[model samples]
Target: MAKIYDFNYKYGEQKVVLPPGKYLLECWGAAGGGGCKITDTNLRSKGGYSKGELTLKKETALYIYTGEKGSNYAPTFNGGGKAMMHEGLSNGETLYCNGGGATDIRLIGGSWDNEQGLLSRIIVAGGGGRNNFETKGGDGGGDAGGDGSKADSKGTQTNGGKGQVGLDGSFGKGGSAVSPSSRENYGGGGGGWYGGGSGYNAGGGSGYVLTENSYKPAGYIPTKEYWLENTSMTVGGGIAEENGKAKITLLQGLPFLVISSYTSEQAVFTAGHTEENKLSKIEWFIDDVLKEAFTTDLYLEKTINYTLEDNALHTLKIVVTDINNMTYEKVVTISKSIMPLPTNANLQDISTKLTEIGEGFKNGKTSIINILALKNIDSSLNNTLVELSEKIKALFDSGDASIENLMNQLIQANNTITQLNSKYKYATGTTEVQKFSGKANMYGGKYGNTFDRNINDWIKIDNLGFVPNIFYAEHENVTVNSVFYKCVVFAICNIPIFSNEQDFTIDTSFSKEKLDNVDFRAAGIVCTNNERDVYINQNGVCIPASNNYFNLHYRWHAIKFI
Candidate 1:
């Protein structure tokens, strides 16, 4: 059997001197004041509360600070008080509990700022938000705290929202905001831990009256009780009894759990109880069935590898039980698809091959046809590279690809293509200019028997020079309905079939929609010493609309002379 002692504090700093041996410590924060309205109406919010345990040795002095309630004011809303505890006196490594914000028509409940280092292990309850004509007050703050009260909008006398009740039975409710029958009537009072008071002369409701004493509300119960015989002792407003039973208090803080990293194949997570020493067991579960249980420690670190068959979401849960049979549980949902994991060596090989192919194309040592003809390469590797490349390209086109993964795959593909190109070399020869003819058509016009010269003789040998460059441009600045001005411009460039030797024939025909004027015509291809220019005419006038914004589609065919 162990001897136990309990001490409680509120409103200020309390210094306690203890004798040697192990002693458990517990604490709670203060509540906030109500808001002040123009008509002597007061609306207040409750403060947050927290509890934790600490072990102390003999002759140790513990410093405790209980926060004060928020002040009631008209211009600014008051914030809830903060509770804190620290060892020694210098305020080093202190634990803090934040207060709630004052009630306001516009502002929600006050927030809790957990102590920096102790946030992971501390249980904090936030103050309730304000309730007004437009919105309800915010629910009590914390993971499992009670919901705030809802606004009663039935008539002039609307009930305020209820405050949330915390695990320790602490409650923070909203004050009623009753509409005044006349300009002289007062508003309702804000809600507190006990409850709200009724409005004065039609004022807002006063804080809920729990016990006869306004200082002590209901649900403020001691976590542990100690009975000492023939001794006089005082604890936080209540007197210590001389009962024979002494209880040990275990400090419970908020649970901290997180998923550090996750992928299609595996997920790594970590979970722990704030009070490490009090933790008795940690159990891991998936979807509901228990997967494993750890009984040695209070903390949990695990990695789960799962198979994703349909790419559906999965749930992972962790349950932690303390020495006092108190348990905390958390669950996380993960969604991912199975992705092929390529080795670094394989990626490097592919990258090397792609580089070779790129260099071969750049130096004109090989063409796309030559590289496509290579054989004896790994089929799976090639397919994987192609799939990755297409997926990466599509992601970029849609503006959704992860850049790091895309770049890595692209580098590997580039290397693989380079290596494939090294196995084949196409014969290189001089490029001879060849004559060719093709037909060009547009939405409202056509040019027949157009002739051009191909600079690459391989275009005739391989019959692979029929690439087209077509584009459309609009001239919104020039507002006119005529075909010469307001109409869209269509242009064609880089027609591989061309001739510089003489003026080639270009018979033109225009549809009625293309040109309202029958006299509208186009200048056939005109060859120059350096370049060629094509022109169009409306009403027998040559319109230099080619330089303006216009749509163009250019393509050509090569007559391979085998």
Candidate 2:
């Protein structure tokens, strides 16, 4: 956002200190008070306007001088010439009005005292001159002061005052006129960069701008106006009719903080203001507590612990201050989901319960053993169990060794299969190869050719649905003198594919004896993101001086290890 400061008519010179930034300055000079004659009225000329741009440093002090309008009897403020009294008038003394003062901005300190003070003026607007009998005062100047209605000449940058009889105006004061006789009573000149000449009616002062981008509007009668094209500084004219005015508007803005991206666990941000100033310091805060402070760098990538409590939320605050001492801050809310942990009793209680359960189980097993012993007294049951056990043992000991050998063989086969599975496992859990090919038109490579790829020459191989881990391309040129020219390019597409960085390698082999005139310079291959298109450089002169195969045929194959 831009800020504006205005300076209106005041008693004396005013000063202001501005920070480092670009600014537009505008000033309007004051108009002289009207003068009257016997049975006739003279019209007062309006003030001239001046505008330009300036780039100031920090703590730059500027002095503003708002012109004060001239009056018939009182002395003019801010360097307007005083009126002259007519002599040899039998009907009492007749006094003429004085010239108006100029409005300007001065770099050096102190009031405008002498002509040497003109060196400190950065910009100035000319004031209108006093009027004469039935003759209107001239308007203020853009480059040079306007001539007075009387026999007085105008002032300019080269010469401050131009009239012989008129009191020559200096840097801040307007030229005063001499009234030798009652018929020769004239008004004073207006004040400006160079004060105007004085005559029966005074001349307007000259306006000035330090830079070339200044502007002065057209049609001020005697004074010519000028304007530069294509600039932010707008038009200027006789806008100020009474007292002069000055305005300073800031063109550039201050710095502010921006959060580029943020997540529950990570955040990326920048402390950037205007291009004119750099950041002085940056502080990061979490939940109202200061976390870290940085000075040199404006960009930061910070990790946050949002999962401190189950389903917890955290507040992130970033504050940045620029070199101008202007500060800005931003706050963001982030949250993370966390699983709750189960609560359990003390360890001693759990151990006691386990011991009781184990003792009961042991006692129950003993009771079962005693009952079985009592039942063993039944001779038939005991004999049947013993016979069944003997049969099973005899079968294994006699000829069942073959069954044992078969079991061992099965175990060995299972162990061998497990080893193979361990050695051949895929990291991605899939081993699928997708292959596709197409035909393309390309120019033959030239000697010392550089790889310059064009987008239009690329061939799209889409609908694969998945990004390939690796890419392999084989291109074959048409038979040159009945010999096939082959090029194989292997590329590893960057993750997300659209990244600027990509890696690929190309290999071309040929016998020098076969085609000595042909030069295999370079081969370029690229696979674009999302579209999965392949682009190859096709800008090169054809090889072999005898062959006119400029449009070489190419068959490309794209292999994707899915």
Q: To one decimal, what is the Cα RMSD in angstroms of model 2 from the true structure?
A: 31.4
Best by TM-score: 2
Error of 2 at 191 (Å): 0.5
Error in Å for residue 303 of model 2: 21
TM-scores for all candidates: the values are 0.26, 0.41
Candidate 2 backbone clash number: 1
* Model 1 regions more than 4 Å off: 1-157, 160-251, 254-256, 263-265, 285-291, 297-300, 304-317, 329-562
Q: How accurate is candidate 1 locally (lDDT)?
A: 0.31
Q: What is the lDDT of residue 281 in candidate 2?
A: 86
- Give each model's whole-structure lDDT: 0.31, 0.55
TM-score of 2: 0.41
Best by lDDT: 2
lDDT of 1 at 17: 52
Clashes of each: 70, 1
